[model samples]
Target: TYTTLDIQNLLAGGAGNPIGHLATPAASRAPGEDEILGRVTLKYEPTDRLTMTLKASYDRNSVNNSSWNYVAFRCGLGSGISQLSGYACDNDKFVTHQNNMPADIAANFPYAKKDGQLYNRYESYAINGNVNYELDNITISSVTNFNRNNNRWTCACDFQSSNNATWATENSTWRSFSQEVRALTSFDAPINLMVGALYQKTRRNFGQWVAFAGLRNSAASPENQFVATSKTSFTKGETTALFGQVTWKIVPTVELAGGVRYTHETKDSFFTQPYNNPGVTGIFRDQNDPDGLGVVNANQTFNNWSPEVTLTWKPSRELLVYGAFKTAYKSGGFSNGGINSKFSTNPLADLTFDPERARGFEAGIKSTLADNQLRLNLTAFTYKYLDLQVDFFNSPIFAFQTLTADAKTRGIEAEFEYAPRAVAGLNVHGSLNYTKATYTKFPLAPCYAGQTPAQGCAAISAIDSRQNLNGAPLSVAPRWTGNFGVAYDTDLSSTLKLGTNVDVRYSGSYLASGFNNPLSRQSKYATLDAGVRVGAWDDNWVIALIGKNLTNRLYVSGVVDGPSTGSGTGTAAGIPADQLGFANLPRTVQIQLTKRF
Candidate 1:
């Protein structure tokens, strides 16, 4: 697959430049990918009450692209015109450009590099086996799975330089094994029960290397080129769990079900980084540790219990209502970098984050009306989260950090499908959702840069404290979302058929940061998609012409607040005030052919 990207504001003149935009057709950004997948399955039944199955699959994917973000240089340009004077702009900002172009006024203007060059390759394979036995009203099953993956990635940190650009490479290997056993019982009475036990183990090895051209050139010899930094890490984890569920038919039209699961997990990790030069440090490290002896070795264990209860009522043959309450939790883990690297001496304590827990309640109804021609479903839910984990990039330190906070979310979802009995192969469907999510209790949260005490920043807080986000809306949580679509199909001939579909999707504006900065919010936007399909040979083979985002709507898919280029100081540290991230993909059209065997 190949696709082009549009980096907004890659040029100094935004969209009014006469020389042409940065992402013009002649200089459009393109990314390419190739993937291959294979799978096989086998099933056997040796007896009336016994069955066995085996499955295996493999996948490999390779991706190559330019920079993910077109970071602009902060050079001061007197006018947005072409000039060749090297002294026309401040050298401090002009030098930030990675390309080899001369530091002329024209070159100083923000221009997105056409080639930054990043490549990634991933390969994985898995095998699974299942066995089942049944006797009378009881059934037993067992499953086993093993998987392994290898990943490699390389990228140029600086795009402008031909042979002197900064670059990084990472390699990772992961392996996992899992087993599960379960038993189910169904009695003559109105009751059913199931119990299961599961165990899993995983291991990972990762390493990264970074180098700079300037440092390499400064080396004593070409054979001893500089190696700014290198990192090596290893992790191992194991988990054991037991779960059970029971359902009882309390009455002719009512049923109640309950389930519980308990899990115990253990994890161990080791990390170390070596600085090749005594004066040089890793991007995530703020101190100069010449010995490169900074190491993180830690082990931790956790145990959790989750439970759920549900009540269902079938008021009639065509109508059903249900309510449920559940409690869930996610395992805690150690941070990979950021603040954790800064506190290398006690990484276990400073870089570790607690598990996330949540309690939720939901009620929903499902109904079929108009002689089964229409189906509708509606649901409302609310949840309270404790220690919700969040990840943010720390511009001040030029690293990423993981944090936890408490939050609450309430939402409603509705969906409907209509197919008039009078018209065959004609159907309409749609769905709508509304979400209200906010931080219920959060202290010591980082405030947006430039935010004052009166504007929600804490007057006096902890070392890293910024704003009090107790009531701020959750990041990426849009309030309103909806989708509508219609499809029609008809017989074109005895063995041929034609089908067409159209869909519209819309989303409301919402904040993109925990600090609720207005600048980080993305306004509402909508897109339309359409497709036509032609089938032959009793629909065994089909071809489709599909068009997505037909309107060519320009919008941001996501945002991360920060400076467009180099890190800033003071209140400008890390905030979405600067729109410098990758833009969403433009309109796409494709033709697809599928066959069934």
Candidate 2:
């Protein structure tokens, strides 16, 4: 194993971008993932005018994942902070003089370690059925759907890589069912009418156990290796909606339509954490602890009336134009996620936020030219969002929380397709997108670990904090994105065909954090992919070879501050917290086969 300083120096002066170049083997490198998926569909017709269809699917996944350890150094400016709480520094600017080790190394380089892997299992089952009956002037239809999901995963909180041994696990389950009925008119008049009504209900539950680190490894002493928390939450939701639309055919080539939907929704939420145990974990803790004193029960109701209007005109058989305006809202819900403590004020009032709403407009044009060999489409859109749900880092709690922010987004998208008549086997397509997404008002955002007073860090309370991120861009909302692809197809035989394609995808730089963590910013990146396939004319069987990220670009996808010391506070905030990021998958090539009946 390489020493701490050795790896530190190699990680670009302790910045640690692109750590894959290091030759050191990982401390732990085993991850397991298994999945099963199946789907089936059936169709029946009793008469030409009546038809029915049913579809069902099931998916199950089991994953055993782990996190590797990383060394940390105490910062020179971090004079009064504790050793393991919300503190980690290894960058050159923050490392203290390493008088505790050989060669006057600045900062202590404690070797990182991990206890075990994280276990997660998920399963989902779904069923859908539809029936349509056609009459003289109107058609009637009904649709029904049901879904169930079960999941359990280890929580990725209390992350510390330097001797901060902790682990947490959560169990969750969800189920929902919905039914909708609709009627449509097909009269010979210049106008058509359609209407539908829907009803749905959902239920979900989650429970978690947090094992905080203690001085001893034994569970014999009730307080040692204590289970910091044993909490559970339950949520139930119901929705009823009625929607209708009317279309007016102004002419053979023009049409105008309007639609409106009214929805009533309700949420029943409950959360609790037991205080009946001596805070012990595993075999020593009581799962049936009677602690009604710590429970929080909450309920919420919402009503929304969404409306939209659209106009479409076809100037010719080869060209079309369309424009639309719409307003919609998302339902509000309680935030009984994790554990809630009575000491933390009213849990419902503090965590629950209003429903997000949006009003937007869009316009588009589509054209086909060059004797139908060339096609182009362009669209532009803008939306004003209020009370957008935002998950942000909280330095005091060392965990992220859900809040609300006001935001806006505007964008333009263009796509083109070309199929040269001269090149009978070749086709080309590409798209370009530009977006601007920013928070208009977010005064209560959390600051990065070490933001100073001058940078807008302040105390909401003795144990809470806030920072102004009034104009920050939305997380993961890149300003620009584009893709280009080319494909060729040829007949190998009367019964067989060959196809090949190549594509390149690109994205502009963007911050990966809602709070705008400097270390979590991602620069622009692009990837190339290619595939080749051979298949029968009927598509009864096929074989293909595909390669992804052929350029092997190791771009960061997302970031989370963890391993133990989550978001740093106090003296630890003076230095940027130890950042943890996830990278895109490496380059790989695989062969796939498919057969259909």
Candidate 3:
């Protein structure tokens, strides 16, 4: 299947620039994708005491996107606005309407004609085998798995009448093999125990290149074009772990459980970009010398222990309470991408980050009311993170960077279901969650675009600065989110059953950037969904009609802050720094059919 998208924007007057303009000429943007998936599973019971299972699957997905971004706004185009003061100007008044805009406008306007295209292909396959053996007093299991993935992405950034456009490509391949063996003792005693050992080895090969089209006299001629490329490669990683867990019945109505895992991992990476193109010297600096250009050969090792403990109490058959404390760890890896040679110069300045560790505590209750007609579960949890891994845009170049910071999160989640015995074939369910996530300590966060030092940023330069986001809430973390739904099913005839369901979901407002700038915030919004299904022959065949986002509410789903550049078709200075991200999809309706054997 292929899909095409037509994006339109309205240029409304703002406080700073109060010259309203009609819609500009529309640009062409389209993205295409294809996906395929397959899986196979086999099981055999050669004997009464042993069983074996094997499974394999494959998935492939590809996408191709091409879009033209029109830079229609420029500074100092409005009346009484001094061009030297750097204010956006409304040039639409000088040109014809969007329907009959002249081609020569591209020559008179200061807009940049940008044509960007991206192609990505990803394929992965995995195979697994498992064996289970039962003994008189215990059960033993062994499993082995292997997986491989290959991905390639290429992007073309073409600008009109400019030699600065670039073509970037990245190719990655991964292979992993893992083995696990476990034993469980089911003794007729008050306590039960299980232990496991696991080992895994993974290898990765990655390559990237960025090519530039140097100064060219004409877009059709490539005689003067030269390409400047940068690349990085990562090679190997291995991990090993041992885990054990035990459960004890301390009393008739209470139980205690504990588990622990010890893990150790090591990784190696290499990077090199041996290119020297004079055309792009002003944009990217080459680090190659007599030794090499930006060559990084490094290795890192990490080890950690994670533990978990839980307690449960059941006073009666209808109610239960539980509490748990757990710890988790994630291994760290190297960072890649960017045109900077800092890694080659400093070697360790920002090459890698520390592992992330988290400690979490949770308590919950489960209850059944009105003689099992209603069920409710509620849980509250708090987690403290040490060296949490975070990804953010590095300034000046807008390259993505990974760092570590201390953070904390607390949240409450609740779910309930009611099925009244008197109301036949009717049920209702709802869930709600509240989260308060914050950065406990982060001193090196970059200030968002247009943010001043007084607004929580530590001044360093006019365009570069850091901020202490110690108490700032985490990006994309909404304080309130909830979903409510009701369902009904009834037998319409001897051979058919009809069912219907409706649900509503909502999310509160949240910041989109680490700087917590109000300009980068998304407002609260809600969506509704409904579905109807008809089944026949004891559900052997079924059909469903579903509708999503019935109201078609338009809202921003994400945001990013970056440099704003203009195409040569507008006045000058293009559009001001504004939030950039995709918006939620409009309302959709679909019908689906299923048959079971």
Candidate 4:
């Protein structure tokens, strides 16, 4: 595959921005990513109206400094720091009347520094054939496609310390195969119709492993070692879809088009784990002993019917308008581990969850101007979601739940592009985009206060009450987001040509909701990127220089809050507040060369 574009990405660790105001200090790790890929294609044309093709593709990706990190300190009774007589006065609960031990340990434990490593490999092979034939007053065509893909990923979290070393590791793989066949027929005159039916099946496999140990001299003992392993398989899922479209020319320059597709999907999955043995201990089982646990099994199935309708209008050659209503479905599945330790006792029966569904409506306009050198497009959309499933970090009090109630989203997006034809050996192009997203409803409240293992079963009565949470904006997703870029190309001389591209993006502040409740919000920031290219040998070979996040702006992209839908707010007052702050990507640069023969 050829390099289509010089793209730059910015990263910010969970902190987003370095600590500038907090009395506590802040630190971050470096970030970088490099990728190389290749593909091949084969085609056969046995007849003028028939063609068959096959394609194979492969990719490898490696990234550094991908782990999560943070900074913080604590001061409390368990800190083991002996305070002056006043220190004992400051906290008396944990100490004698004269010893000021705070009611709770004042822990200021700093956030951990994350150094992440990830390896990914992907492969896909596909074959397709199409045939077109004319019969009397109509033209008919048949098309078929078969495709298979396999993906593997391994990632690790590095502690980067001499002691207190801990690591979270994961290994996962997915394989999918599918086939579809359809036919289209249209009349020769102004009236035309196309109808088709398609069937597809796919399967996926998933696995994970995690291990960690401290750096102490004797930390490797059986009690100190920690590890977990799991495996899941989805044997087969089927989808059947039917579609039809009709177009009336009305006149030579004016035409109207309408189409609809109805799709039914059914899926089945099986999960098993063989590592639980008798030797496991602590809050979780120990996978190191094969006899500690027995194999666990789970089965799940779901079916959904999705519908879509679209209309296209073209009054002239330079403009087009379209509107569509569509419904999309994502298969439901089960989680291998349950929220409570008690659920682990019956692993085979407790891991499965349900499916989620969404419906959307959108309308947009596209137009070209400036002698076809400039293009602009805009779309507005609104969607309703039922049984939305969200994943969150489990907390000590209320357990995490992946299911969410009714939700709604409404937003609009616009993109504009301008490219000037080469003039006097110089060419230039620029583009810009903007979008806004919001949530119509989010259910949240405080669960059992001062109760151990909080009972999160609580309902709301007032739609506008602080707990009702209607009209609250969705966390993590920025309300305003956009990017702009401009590029210029020219020949410096006969043997050398130069090109430069620059792009910038800005994201609005958003609340972190990884913990399930909204906490503090991160500040907004912008980033700039630039690159230059030089070429020789009739432009067959070229060297490029790139710089990313030139501004070095610090920003956080996401945050974690306490539990939602449950009363166990993690805050000091049993209130939910944001926690984890997903840092943004850092600035980086690279030099690359490419050659063609």
Candidate 5:
């Protein structure tokens, strides 16, 4: 017996007349988001060993945005806001001099229109316990868990006419508590063992006015026709972790598993001061405790290790096979608190950077066919990396180097299932995958153009180590993906009941570079989904008709760099390319109802 209840609401909309992205100027300033979700689960067992479970959850999300917009290269022209209206001198950093309009409309178009309001709240509570013990040859088992989580976020923004006008108003509160302890052992000979350990911790707080700003750009510019002012920043960090695992059965079809884990981490940041422009000097200093950053001591510590191994084979029992080796690590960070960096008086050395690595290998197969109505599984993998911490554009770069431009990934995964229970209740499932990532050696950073006789004021550096990135592919990793499903149940004779389902997914073409800059590409798309169900009496109803991107294909996920290098390359066009995507959710229809006690 099973009981469940769920309620979901989501609304997203976009209606013409809003376009801006000549390299991500907040992408026309977001506006549309409303979400709500509720769920419940319960299970019970009367005797023989004891089992009970209960879970509850709720979430609410809201957003109506517009933080900053005014393209055309903040007013210099490289085609953004799609050039807003008119200004094209054959593009690519135009040059034909004066009275040509496209210089941010002669400098007074100083735009900053971002209206925002946000609310987020989530709640969850869970309890689960299980026990079974019998000692004859040795059989003992126990499982226990408890969970509680609560989160909150509030926001307000407006940055129109400079007193900085509130732009970011904030509040954040989070609480999490969890516990898990388990033990189990059973042996008859042929070598057998099981052992486990796990622990966790979480704490967070941002009381109120945590810190906020919607969008900004203004180091004060209006010369050679380039005016600027756009800013949007928000910060919060708090975390903790603990983990462990093991299993072995040396013989009886060979089964072995091993695991190791160790982790400890902490981070803190709070900032709000420096709305610059009256007399700028050294990182725009103007403070009175917008979370204080001058001598307010901050701390960071991290240690991480994860190791895993598994090998299993069983010639029979429906044919099974497995192989795996794993090691993963990601930790090391700090930066993003603002203020201090006219070139640093040292705000912790303007925030530090380092930490990123992964090593993995896997192989797999599981099968059952024809005789039992078909079922299959397959897997293949490869990963080796190091120090690859990249976030470029939001500022953070270690520059893709496994050692000297090393990052090779391989993948192949497949799954299939078909059930023909004489057609009484039909079912079919499917999955397919193929992944590829490349970059054998990438390093070549150099810039600085025009007016060079003694090279003193124009400079850009980091020249050569080796580069070969085969021109884009591996920005969200999607070299081809697939999924399919269909299910049916017929029985409208007693108590009236009928159920139906359908699902399909396909993805190919992915490159949303976080900055390796290979002509900036993000193109590839495919999607399909559907569902229907109905039940009477005890009450369970669902009338669903859902469709998304039923082939409304138009791609561009993200791209960057169009300026900001030495800022003058025959006209400057080396570090500016912007396009961010996943913008698909064009069709929708829904109806659902469920109840049980």
Candidate 6:
């Protein structure tokens, strides 16, 4: 549900619960986002054999995501005043609301804070130049690029209704430069070749403020008290790569192609929050201030090779078949949720992770039939992914972390486009895919609420919690997903035309949290969308009206575990609620007007 609800006593035979998330129940007002971008390009051809192109761009975006809030019921010792309804409440979720004694800090309390969920601003600039020279049957090209980005964001780390966590913010800057040079041969020979080399360097600086109030189940941060921990970090990286590709046309209807790339990369980062003081009184210092306490700096190098090979056959002008095998790699990096106390207990959480790698193969066929009226394609693929990067939201820490896992997956995809001869202005297109993805090794996946010791659940707070998920499916919906769309266009007059389209999408059930969280499961659903367009037969102006999600399916798109919620104990342990759900947008309509230049 988009809004949170207090379902303590209202489930079976109780009276009812309260609503959450939305601040103005009777009104709707949203902020306006602004974005600006400018670009310029220049091209020159001084000689018949040489050409040069240069482009530069600047972009800025300001966003305000401060319109969301939520209220939830947690387990407290006895009963306390309900913050949302101002009512007295024992155990809340499935029992009576209770509060704690004067001495007990863990009291069942109401959590219903509102507004300023998030805000962000970003600005970037880029400049790129390309040079190409042609000689005989070979063409040599070089590309150089320089880019910079500055970004900032703030969040009310506390998702509850209380002002418990008015503390999370970040500022970051990144600068990068890269250059690549390659030569390609386009000779009318049986063999073709392409070779390239690339070098890149990037530098980044970041700073963040952790939750000053800290995450609590039934409590808010001390008023006028500032316990925010300040942390700053930096990263520097350099990479060099060499790649080449060869294509051999063995026969008129058969061909073979292969390519390989070797990369050497080095990374250096200050991954520790040395300035963070894990005491009752936290120091408010920035990253620039020299206060070295903790220790988790990363200075590592990695080498990898990526290769791909393909063979193709064409039996006729309209039919083609191909198969290929490929390998890929992604470098690992540090995380930046600031100094987390859980890291002290689970040192691995603060350490750098291994690189992620994948090897896969695919076979596909493409065909056109019925006098160019039909086009169809099909592909089957399988892959083994090692050290896959997975993102998790640690509700207690109000931070995001990246974990690693090993997975295996196989899938098939099919698509088709058709234009019936009987209907000159009608077209139909659709695609379908089915995948089976499973975690071959994931011993420390986050457990859902209420998971017990028998379930291999363990925790040092929600941020460092884990459970066994080795045999679970990697994707929530590992079955079938597909979409079908149809469009029709007809000329109404010599200068006007009418166009209409309808699309439908279907998906199997999946977990909103991506992990195997039972409480965050989303049921199988389908949606319908349709649109109408009218224009002066292309050359001028056009108007379009579109309706999206006409079925108005109510489903959760993602979730964040509530405070101490994923500790696997749940409210039964007098903690926070299981999870907070973010719902997908409902049915909506839009009207657009366009003019061609």
**lDDT (C-alpha) at residue 485 in model 5:** 80
Write out the backbone clash pairs for model 2.
98-105, 98-106, 159-563, 159-564, 159-565, 160-563, 160-564, 160-565, 450-573
Off by over 4 Å in 5: 1-249, 265-279, 286-292, 302-311, 314-320, 323-329, 336-363, 366-475, 479-507, 511-521, 524-558, 561-597
lDDT (0-100) at residue 305 of candidate 2? 93
lDDT of 2 by residue, 429-490 (tens): 99999999999999878766655565566767776656888888988899999999999998
Preferred candidate (TM-score higher): 1 or 4: 1
TM-score each candidate: 0.82, 0.82, 0.80, 0.69, 0.26, 0.79
Model 2, total clashes: 9
Q: What is the C-alpha lDDT profile of model 5 across 479-506, one tens digit per residue?
A: 8888888888777867866768677777
lDDT of 4 by residue, 1-597 (tens): 000010000112311111111111112333234566676677777766656666656555544333332210111222322121112211112111111111111121111122223333455555555555555545555556666665543322222221112233333444444444444555568877877777777666555433322111123333222332233344556777777777777767556666667666665655444332122222233333244333434444565666666677787888988888878777676553332222245444344556777899989988997888878888888898776665643333212345455567778888887777745333343333343444445456332222122323233332111243345555566777788888777787888888888888877776554222423355566789999999983889899999998886655555332111113232233322213244554567879898986
Model 6: per-residue lDDT, tens digit, 106-215? 12211111232345678999999999999999999999999999987654444443322233557889999999999999999999999999999998998765433332
RMSD of 3: 9.4
Local accuracy by lDDT, each model:
0.65, 0.67, 0.64, 0.47, 0.44, 0.65
Across residues 174-211, which tens digit of lDDT does each residue of candidate 1 receive? 99999999999978878999999999999988776654
- In the order shown, what is each candidate's alpha-carbon RMSD? 8.7, 9.3, 9.4, 12.4, 26.6, 9.0
TM-score for predicted model 2 compared with the true structure: 0.82
Off by over 4 Å in 3: 1-32, 66-117, 156-167, 211-226, 281-287, 290-293, 338-344, 396-399, 460-464, 555-557, 565-576
RMSD of 6: 9.0
Candidate 2: minimum summed lDDT over ten consecutive residues — where?
97-106
Query: Comparing 4 and 6 by TM-score, which wins?
Result: 6
Q: Once superposed on the true structure, which residue ranges of model 1 sit more than 4 Å away at CA? A: 1-29, 66-116, 156-166, 217-226, 282-293, 337-346, 395-399, 449-454, 458-465, 562-577
| True lDDT of residue 390, candidate 5 | 49
